[model samples]
Target: MSQKSLLLTAKQGSFAVGTTPIPKPGPGQVLIKIQSAALNPVEWKIQAYGLFIEKFPSVLGSDIAGTIEAVGEGVTGFAKGDRVLNQGTRGDNNEFSGFQQYALANADVTAKIVSSLSFDQASTVPVGLATAAVGLFNQGKSNSAGLYPPWEENGSGRYAGQPIVIFGGASSVGQYVIQVAKLAGFSPIITTASLTNADYLRGLGATHVLDRKLSAEQLKAQVSSITSASIQIVYDAISEADTQVAAYDLVSSGGTLVLVLANSIPESKRTSDRKIVNVFGNVNAPDNRATGASLYKQLTRLLENGSIKPNRVEVLPNGLQGIVDGLKKLQAGVSNIKLVAHPQETA
Candidate 1:
């Protein structure tokens, strides 16, 4: 069997839609007939900047939602035609990657798609949700805050009355963090974003949405006014140098500051007591697989009950080829909306 895919023909080269053999699921995996695949900034960065991949003819995509086409050996609890969503892998394993009509997903981290969401909406969940879940709930200081996951026993509302701050509240990952913080019982959930998105962010559980452009001093004063209690958790979804600096400055002693990108905060500004943890957002990674599996188990209920929601999606054109164009738009920058493509729609 063959499938259409968007391929990077060379290092720092143009992407083209080409035919490739459809991948069959290995043991413990399932073949997904992809309905929707999302484009992320990392995808374009990999091609234009030649990062995270050394192999030519790479297939780059991470978020995927579709129906199970075939089940592999020992893969129970899932059957052909089941609606599901998962994170796609790249570089080392092209067969497990998205941006193609069919890809293999380990059943462990794949979640069933509730009737409430379309494939496009479900496609937005894996990467963003994983980033938030691992950073806040993973019990490891190296990459997370080491806090209890709300979906676990006696975990919901555990942080009630405690203040939590997040930068980029309107971003895909930040929105999930706000929702997760609400479940964890964090009170006075504050975030930074454009004033235009304040209401939407508030609807997502953010109590306050300060202007993202606010100077560090102004944001500090605003946060101070929201609560006298020290902020114990800060998730910086943007993680630019300025944002990291401001986020770090806002962290209370011993509080954890979660960044999505590499630490860029200057050494001179660092403090011994405050912690900065950089999250590797891909849940498929070995270190994060268990948490990823746990999150997947609870994901369906979370979406069905409205406890968690998907990012709004903007569908692109030309199926797999549309992904080629969408990556350029992602490189330009996007707001809260995620760009999604229907790989099976390819010509």
Candidate 2:
């Protein structure tokens, strides 16, 4: 059987709905019937900017939620009909790169989706939550028990009672970081968002919300008053020159900063004790599979057990055609919530 998909042919171009051969799962792989695919800013940016992908007619989504339709030889612990969510492949020809009705995902990258989460909600999670988890626990080493329970003692000694600031609190990534930081026992989780999103961010565990409109000095003062000690960990979900500069001022000596985007760090900004980290959102890279798998499993448990809630998703109609329109909305930035496109029909 063949499968239909929405393929991006070139930079800043419309997605073409086309049919491709149904891919069979290989060793350590599982074939999935995609239920919903979530759109991220990176999706449109990549399509518009045309970086990373080396070829045309590529499937671009990374956050995917679906059900297992087939399992390859040597794959264990998964069966047909199992609902799953995973970070899709970064390569152009990979079967699990998303934006398709059917995908073949690496078994290790797949995690059972929480029963309470809709496919849309599940689809919105893996990229943002996994990125936040890696940035906070793996890179920044923030003492949050939610991510690294075994490292609690180490994190506690380093970060307990210390303040951490997230520069874009209302973003899907920032919201998860706030919740994880709170659960890890970090105190005074501070963030920045527009006035409309201030209360929303506070509801998601933000101790303080700085208005983005505020002058840099005013923002700094607000953050300063939130913690007696200087901000020790900074996660920049929105990495612009101004935000980076403000984050540098917020951090004291020896504090760590993590930036999600791949912007270049200025030489003058380097400090002997301060470290700046960049997250590429590729948690499931071969070398980091263990950590990536563990985090996905933990996030699934957290969502299933209500330890963490799924982010809001704006759902469009189901079908491959709807996906192109949804991507346009994402590019225009008209919607505040994540946009999810369901490619399958449901009763």
Q: Which candidate achieves the best lDDT against the true structure?
A: 1
Looking at model 1, which ten-residue stretch has the lowest summed lDDT?
A: 137-146
Task: State the TM-score for model 1.
Answer: 0.98
- TM-score on alpha carbons, each prediction: 0.98, 0.90
The local distance difference test score of each candidate is 0.91, 0.76
Cα distance off (Å), candidate 1, residue 184: 0.9
For residue 40, what is the lDDT in candidate 2?
81
Worst window of 10 by summed lDDT in candidate 2: 142-151
Candidate 2 CA-lDDT value: 0.76
TM-score winner among the candidates? 1
**Candidate 2 TM-score, C-alpha based:** 0.90
Flag regions of model 1 displaced more than 4 Å.
Answer: none
* Tens-digit lDDT track of model 1 for 252-338: 998989999999999999989998999997778887888888888898899999899899899999999888778888878888899
Local accuracy of candidate 2 as per-residue lDDT tens digits, 148-233: 53233444234458688888888888888787787776778889888798888878888888887777799888876777786678
